[model samples]
Target chain A: MELTAPDRHLIAALEGGLPLVARPYRELARGAGLDEAEVIDRLAAMVDGGLIKRLGVIVRHRELGYEANAMVVWDIADARVDDVGDRFGAFDFVTLCYRRPRRLPAWPYNLFCMIHGRQRQAVLARIDELGRVPGAAGAPREVLFSVRRFKQRGATRLGTAAAAEAAP
Target chain B: MTTFEKRLLDEFQRGFPLVERPFAAIADDLGVTEAEIIETLGRLRDEGMVSRVGAVFDPGAIGASTLAAMAVPPGRLDEVTALVNGFDEVNHNYEREHRINVWFVVTAPHRARLDAVIAEIGERTGLEVLDLPMQEAYHLDLGFPLQWN
Candidate 1:
């Protein structure tokens, strides 16, 4: 959906979060230069358009005792990748799953899923169990545990420039 | 965190009310006063337990993005990291225990812009840039269901 000037203004207003109050949209509408009703309607439209993936409390797993985060990747055969990926997504612990292009002679793993737990041992154990899935039995896989996170922030591209221009 | 806080975090990861009084709506469902819900969320944000209470836009809808990696030598890891982080396009940069140690995500408003950023990084770093863009995703959009123990 092509965003209108008001839509950009409203999204920019939402970059941080909704104010925890009785009438949050009123606050957003004020910032976006729209009225309360339009702000709510446009936001609902954005969600319906598949632009806003989710709208609610965004939890931080690591801060909530999920310290060990592992990106377990698999080199599944092209024909069965979609099938396997679907099955992987059904697992309760698989928070994220995606199929990406595999770089030849360097990175062979294409199917990726994130399994985060409080203990490294538990995460590894879960990965071992995941490897036992029918079509996943013979696939090559590797787990990359996060060593350090230099930067972890939301994708701010949509609003950064627009917000600045709208400011003042 | 209180039991109420856990329930709030778990149950409200999505389906936030788009009404004029959203917090009040959440309060009605959770059997808490609107003021209390607001206060707890504020505390959670301070503790980093909650990133925010807002819309998570589809990054693809916003721009083009890819996961890129580089095998930076140990001595130059920090230097290389500083350089990479300097780019506004790179949002997540991490060090993992592998030969392809330094991995980061790059996002740009257009495919050409995304490619130019990756190419420039390869040139400046003099390293093979392993660009991995998503071909398909089987993601569950409801967000993570917290296992609060």
Candidate 2:
């Protein structure tokens, strides 16, 4: 959908984010020349439309003192994938879970998940529990632990600054 | 597009100040009121154009695991997704254009358990689960300009 001027303005602002304040919405509304209710309404609509998936705090696991992390990939039977993926998603420690097409030659994972914890042991234990899950009884899986953080930031549309700068 | 949208994207990429009045601070810098900043964010969020506006973190900091993917059969996409998402450790899964179509990330506290989970998945799913542990992260930032129409 072609975003309206107001919509574009809103996206640009969100790309930056709300200021940390007691009443961030009210403050933002005033600056953007819109009412707080409008802002809320727009966000609600965007979320409903799937333009924006969710609005929440991006927890900095590292800053919060989480130390070790890894990525686990799974190849489950096509028939029982639902049963297995659902079981995987049910775990409290598991943070993310989704399905993607299995890559060949170079990669081969059909199902994916992310789990987090305070220590490597804790994370591993959770993975162990997933292993025992009846749904994933015969699925193949892989784990890629993060060695370093290359870059991290909340999602952003890259070239808005240049576009904004180039604007008259 | 208006200046508000431009500034929002630019400022967002740069970083948000972690202060008591972070929004107000941004407003002061941009010569706008804090309310404007919040409203704009709310609007963008509503429009389904952006995913999140919060802290970005290194998964490794917290004992977590992650991975990438390849082709999944067309027929069993939903089933595989359900099984994969079932794990709490699973986060950030997406379908990429490749032979190994299905890609996902998993994080666990320890290595042994992660392996066992992998083993279990192989046994249950009956697919060759290729474990591509991150040998070296050359570049890993997906946040990019969304101006490509």
Candidate 3:
């Protein structure tokens, strides 16, 4: 998108995210040399245009006292994916849900889900319950838990060299 | 456009520097004052070029299991979104570019309820749910630079 100068300025400013402040939007307006309303309106428009995915808090579950978490992949029947996906998406616990192309030979599961909780046992119990879901029954599944948090952050581009060097 | 903005965005992708005056440190490195950096970043946020500034963690690390997506017809999207948003577990949903549209992620206190919830949704919505799961996480991060020419 050919952004206007103001748009460019705003885009550049927001790329990092809102500064923790008493009035975040007001602070942003002062920085961008635009009024508070203009800053808010532009942001709202950007969100509406599908440029900004979401505006919300980014949290650390471990710090928040949630200890256990896992990625559950499901080999759901292609024909029934839509039906099962909706049911799964409605859950309050699942934070992210999406469909990605399954890499042949390396990947077989099409349906992926995430569960987080205070304890491993608690998360596992939820997995067992998922196994009993009529729509989820007979689906091949696997759970991959994070052994260590190498890195985590909101949307931004950084560490290209470090990441590329680490890639093998 | 300044390389300072790019650097800031890049630094934040993996994580923000946990410091007393992180912005000041960033400003010093970029040859700008802390006030200038803060002002610039605020403008970017107001413009909607950036979404948020915070942490992104691995669900598995925290005990969230069961992730999935459902495809809804264009007409029924609104009704379905309302239904999905009712759950506190559902952080957010997105409209993606694919055949199986209306992708959402669900985290649960445990896996059993996650499964049951999926089943319940299927039963309630009368839609055949495709349970696609992750086998291997290869190249998961999607952080890209803002190209300014």
TM-score of 2: 0.49
Per-residue alpha-carbon lDDT of model 1 for A90-126, expressed as tens digits? 8888888889998888989989998889899999999
Clashing pairs in 1: none
Model 1 C-alpha lDDT per residue in residues B48-112, reported as the tens digit of each score: 78878987777566557888999999998988899889888887898888888998988765677
lDDT of 2 by residue, A59-141 (tens): 33443345455567778876776677777776666666666555565555667677655577877877888889986756687
Candidate 1 chain B: minimum summed lDDT over ten consecutive residues — where? B140-149
Decreasing TM-score order of the candidates: 1, 2, 3
> Rank by DockQ, descending?
1, 2, 3
Model 1 DockQ, alpha carbons vs. true complex: 0.63
* Model 3 per-residue lDDT tens digits across residues B1-149: 46776676655554343344556766677788878766766666555444456433333432244445666787987777677665544554555434455555565544555677678777777765554444333222233232232
Per-model C-alpha lDDT, please? 0.84, 0.55, 0.55
1 versus 3: better DockQ goes to: 1
Q: Give the backbone clash total of model 2.
A: 128
Looking at model 1 chain A, which ten-residue stretch has the lowest summed lDDT?
A159-168
Strongest candidate by TM-score: 1
Residue-by-residue lDDT tens digits, candidate 3, A123-168 = 8888888777767888888776644332232321111223212322
Q: What TM-score, computed on C-alpha atoms, does each candidate reach?
A: 0.89, 0.49, 0.47
List ranges where model 2 is wrong by over 4 Å.
A1-5, A30-33, A46-54, A157-168, B1-149
